[model samples]
Target: MTRIPDQPKRLRIVPISKLAAAPKWQLETLRALREPVFFWFTAGQGRITLGGSTRGVHPHNAIYIPPGTMYGFQAMTRTQGVALHMGDPTGLDLPETPLHLRLRDGSQHAEVAQIMDAIQRELEGAKDFAERAARHQIGLLAIWLERQRSSAGDDSPRGLSSTNANERLTARYSTLLERSFGSALNVGDYAQALGVTPTHLTRACRASCGRTALQLVQERRLYEARRLLSETDVPVQDIARNLGFSTPGYFSRAFSAHTGTAPSLYRKARGA
Candidate 1:
């Protein structure tokens, strides 16, 4: 069956248990993804670590982890869940930081469940304009989440209108990184663009995601490098130049340091 059809090719929907089977899940440090993921836990309990924060997850709770966020998931019970992996889904707004929410009302839970089912159906049977239709459904889910936060009383300060200052700054920095990663932008340049000092930006990054601003830029660069290597026949030297690297040797060293493999071999291993 199709999973997250009509969504970006990188987007995926899969069972939580299957995700947990990856080798990184057993390690003390979990490898993160280049896209955001929302986990809907139907049954059982688990613990999700996002950045420097860890939270407990129960049935009917939804957890979101943004891209480049270091995270790990653990299930203490027989966890049954659906993971929605996303890539800049347009027309949908969500929290910038990791989120864990419990839909205590039966109707609320039912509505969310229905939306997820509709997403699956669109992927499976909607052959015409399927991507557009699926996006509309996904938008509905985002609106549903926003409504829940609004009705959730004062604790919903994380909404678009009133996200925490640190998180907002970090989110802004993240958005800028997404748009400008191809250029040779430094941390100071990013800070200047955001109208904040490099130190202030670093403080915000530390408070919000437990990573430095430089790391974010590097991560984005590496993500792009890997994508080029695995999805195209682009020569490593050409890829390096495209990504603004001064030399192929530097790119190769950086790639090796981050992935523990040379760029060409990594590409070959993925059957590119």
Candidate 2:
């Protein structure tokens, strides 16, 4: 019998180490997710770039990223934590903007850990009402986030402020890239749409994320390519068309160059 491709889960708790085990580009590349993510770090330290600003993240740090925000981080150390992917925020009391909290209170740390563990149990148990249980746990986690943000006051990560002109431009560019990556828009097109020259855009992106505008676009497209190849049974040709590649052959070459493996082989190795 053939296996059905697994759909992306809405509610889940993933270990930080497991997430780090994937190819670095998947997480370290500047990109956005469609769902809100709450990362609770229990050990290790590294720098995380969010909203075009980079900052140091240590143990007990909690980062909340709303959907459509551009963010990435370095798995420089033996990072140990749990990442909670909250499906839909329709009625949840989550913050509208990104938040990076350096949690110093022991009780606060324990509270987050417990909430994550509870969500994990509900998801893994496969018991009756597990979905409902998980949702409730997520609600509680949102409340915890609110209280922590309120008490922390000015929960901004340091380094570069999002208001910096270059950072702001980079943030806008990233947002547009995330929304239109599947289209055939090139870096020049993006720069024109943003009322800036291609060179300026590239410079801003480099300053903000150490990547040129073209590199950012290529990475974002390839990231989605890998996701489709590893997570779904979509044909390589379809994936190419969907991602705006002119032809399957061109897509294969690009994918091979980026991953050092053909799309088919990548999927087969993953047993997708």
Q: What lDDT score belongs to each candidate, Candidate 1 first?
A: 0.70, 0.82
lDDT tens digits, residue span 1-272, model 2: 22323325387788988887777887688778778999988888888878766678898888899888888888655889989888876777777778788777788778888888898999999999997888888889888877766665332442123358888898889889988888899999999999999999999988977889999888888888888788888888888887789999999999999899999999999998
Which ten residues in a row are the worst by lDDT in model 1?
1-10
What C-alpha lDDT, on a 0 to 100 scale, does residue 257 get in candidate 1?
94
lDDT value, residue 128 of candidate 2: 100
- For each candidate, what TM-score against the reference? 0.70, 0.86
Candidate 2 wrongly placed segments (more than 4 Å)? 1-7, 124-127, 151-163
Please give the distance, in angstroms, between residue 243's alpha carbon in candidate 1 and its true position after superposition: 2.5
Error of 2 at 194 (Å): 1.7
Candidate 1 stretches with Cα past 4 Å from truth are 1-12, 20-39, 43-58, 63-79, 85-100, 125-143, 157-163
lDDT of 2: 0.82
